[model samples]
Target: MSQIQGWAAQQAGQPLVRSSFDLGPLGAEEVEVAVDYCGICHSDLSMIANEWGMSRFPFVPGHEVIGRVLALGEQAKGLRVGQRVGIGWTAGSCMHCRQCLSGHQNLCAELEATIGGHHGGFADKVRAHWAWTIPLPDGIDLPSAGPLLCGGITVLKPFLAYNIGPTARVGVVGIGGLGHMAVKFAKAWGCEVTAFTSTAAKADEARSFGAHHVVSSRDANAIQAIAGSLDLLLVTVNVSLDWGALLGTLAPRGRMHVVGAVLEPIPVPAFALIVTEREVSGSPTGSPVDIATLLDFATRHDVRPQVEMFPMDQVNAALKHLADGKARYRIVLEGAKG
Candidate 1:
């Protein structure tokens, strides 16, 4: 029957349960990954609840995946059997598109998300296009490397896309899954990092993640205290905040780059941007080459996501922990190892 086993949600807002799918032969460019460790991202919660209105029934929700190559399609390129690899949010793209031809496959109009139309890594095996299946480097920490596939790339893309310089001052809002990694990447990229959190208790932990300064994202005065300072402010929380105060922290010509999936519409005061010539921008996770670059940079700088571990069979518990906002940073599901 070609049955593949995984955890799946029968409907929105339901807990996942054991399920199987009769997936046929792999595609020409496909590579199958045997799940070893998969990170639980906030987006997984959203999809499971249909927050983005794109959830599919009987869905397997996972994207920040670390695994080993189990099989390859006839035309899959650049990888061999039994190789260790990772897959992020994207699983495939139409290679003939302009975005793909230009090395921006992540921006492809027909992008296929790992957990969107496709079953993802919360399972015995998952499949993705050869390009999106990234190669992990030597000396990389396998256990903690899963979140880097998604959250790591989400925060790292801004620096490369916008050319954020080493001397630039960077501020990261919300010191959780995405923000912590942003702090580390900013520090390793030679930028001075400022970490902001609504929870004062996380201030010290944020500092430990490489922030030079820590502030309360909810404190208007604290936001003003660092006013006109940062060259780039990376917002990583999905929740709404004091947007105006945070916007004011940027230096003249500074940029506010958001990687979080904040659901509310952000009202930007035009004057706030006009006077200082500041800018606002956002990006999805990076392309194949960009992910490879992130992996290489992380290896050389010894940067990795801080993660809490859970057994794959205990995935429902892990998802609940993330939903209740109790995860210290990130959660990763451990599967059977080779």
Candidate 2:
């Protein structure tokens, strides 16, 4: 109803500055959230830099949002005012579409992204369709749960989609954000977990995150040593790696899934797949139901992203920290303070 305050990048590659704008009346199916905390995702940086060539200026970038309902439209359902909730990438969808009807709203042809052509959660307030605003479970620690909305769901969807079992030997490539969560999830699922990373320093840290073993992603010898051992390998980095060597690590009938938004083409030798009957796949964030399941799983297993906190006003510095690759894992912005 009043002017909503936020930080925005007025131009590509520029620092976010304080900005205020009107958020028209709430839609019938929309609910407004008073943001409490918002996770700074790499996707947010990409959007700010116009990396995908789809960004709009005066962009407010945040999608992994943790907040309380401030107001609800008359038609909003299943959530109450003042309820804690988390909103991820998908904000709204054509609810009558086959994808939406089948409970895969993330795949709807007309899905609305939280930060696409709209304001996101890096603000004092934000809004989303009721379906995408999921109530936080009682047990989840709100501060750390923000990343679960995006990075968590991105990695967790592969496990659900591939029917990964407790007995599966899972390898997680990259020891940052999504990769870290993959390790935790695999171990908690009763799988033998292996972490692959280029940085030697992160190996021990990866082990602490539930990785039973760690291997150098760039070392042919180390990568070769684990040949044919993993039932599933989840790649979470956005850079191209030695695909052939990584493929060799998969057991017969194993799968390599990419959750990261790698800009480069992945070169996979046909023989690599033919010889081992291996497969490659990728997925976006999970459906709303899947997010809820992930939250429950995290709560039951006591899994959460390791995070550093910054006030929303210091978003530019936080962005720079992530850009410099200094974030231990993830960063979260405490919403506008009094």
RMSD of each: 1.1, 1.1
Instruction: Assess candidate 2 and give its TM-score to the true structure.
Output: 0.98
lDDT per residue (tens digit) for residues 1-338 in model 2 = 64789889999989998899898888999999999999989999999999998888899899999999989999999999999899999888889989999988899999999999889989999889999999999989988899999999999998888899999999999999888888988888899999999999999999999999999998999999999999999999999899888989999999999888888899989998998799999999989999999999999999989999999988999999999999889999998641
Q: Candidate 2 overall Cα lDDT vs. reference?
A: 0.92
Q: Per-residue lDDT tens digits of candidate 1, residues 1-338?
A: 24679899999999999898988988889999998999999999999999888998898999999999989989999999989899999999998899999999999999999999899899989999998889888888999999999999999999999999999999999898999999999999999999999999999998888999999888888888999999999999988998989999999999999999898999899999999999999999999999999998998999989999999999999999999999979999999772
TM-score of each: 0.98, 0.98
Q: Candidate 2 regions off by >4 Å?
A: none
Residue 79 of model 2 has an lDDT of 95
- Global lDDT for candidate 1? 0.93
Model 2: per-residue Cα lDDT at residue 133:
95
Measured with C-alpha atoms, the lDDT of residue 210 in candidate 2 is: 93
Query: Stretches of candidate 1 above 4 Å error?
Result: none
